[model samples]
Target: MRKLFATAFSLWAATAAQAENCQIIGNQTLCDDGVSGQRIGNTTYWNDGSSSQQVGRFTYNSDGTSSQQIGNHTYYSDGTSSQTIGTTTYFSDGRSCRRIGNQISCD
Candidate 1:
């Protein structure tokens, strides 16, 4: 159907636009949309840089274990979200998570 085709094209175009901003710098691909991912030395890292502080990292180590953090702007499947303005994550259950500045509160 024409409507289905248009909807699919719109989704694909949006995704392509989001992916096109990254630039290959050395081993890193840096994007204007607050994400940078690269292999730095022996470690692989992805970071969020929505603000000057750029507050999170997912890193892979040579030993096979990995470490990660969520910050800057994070969104949950429940439509809760976080960013420099702080964040809220809601669960399908009654529980919720919230962060304001450096403080985190959950229920």
Candidate 2:
């Protein structure tokens, strides 16, 4: 039971860390991970200090790699992806975060 509790805590901490880096400041959602986005109509335009180009729903990185969001699924350039089903966003890394009100809780 202790092991399970520890594991749960770790996952919670990871999710908290990710959520802490992100904030809803005015009209933009900003993150310390070098990504910020603003929704315009049906598309969310992302800026990472390099570009603000919106091709479909993908955000291109400065490294020539890009990440795209289709429906609720996000495809990253690193071959990893995440999907949002309901109020939760599940990462390819096995982490899942749930949106609670204006905050995110993960486990």
Kindly give the number of clashing pairs for every candidate. 1, 0
Candidate 2, after superposition: displacement of residue 70 in Å? 2.9
Rate residue 28 of model 2 by lDDT.
Answer: 59
> How well is each residue in 8-86 modelled by candidate 2, as lDDT tens digits?
2111112233334344454455555545566454334455333333456655444465566778777666686777777
Q: How accurate is candidate 2 locally (lDDT)?
A: 0.46
- Candidate 2: RMSD over Cα atoms? 10.0
lDDT of 1 by residue, 11-78 (tens): 00011211223344565544455455554443335553211111134332233333223554333322
Q: Kindly report which residue stretches of model 2 are placed more than 4 angstroms away from their true locations once superposed.
A: 1-21, 30-53, 105-107
Q: For candidate 1, what is the TM-score?
A: 0.25
Residue 52, candidate 2: Cα error in Å is: 5.6
| CA lDDT scores, all candidates in order | 0.31, 0.46
lDDT of 1: 0.31
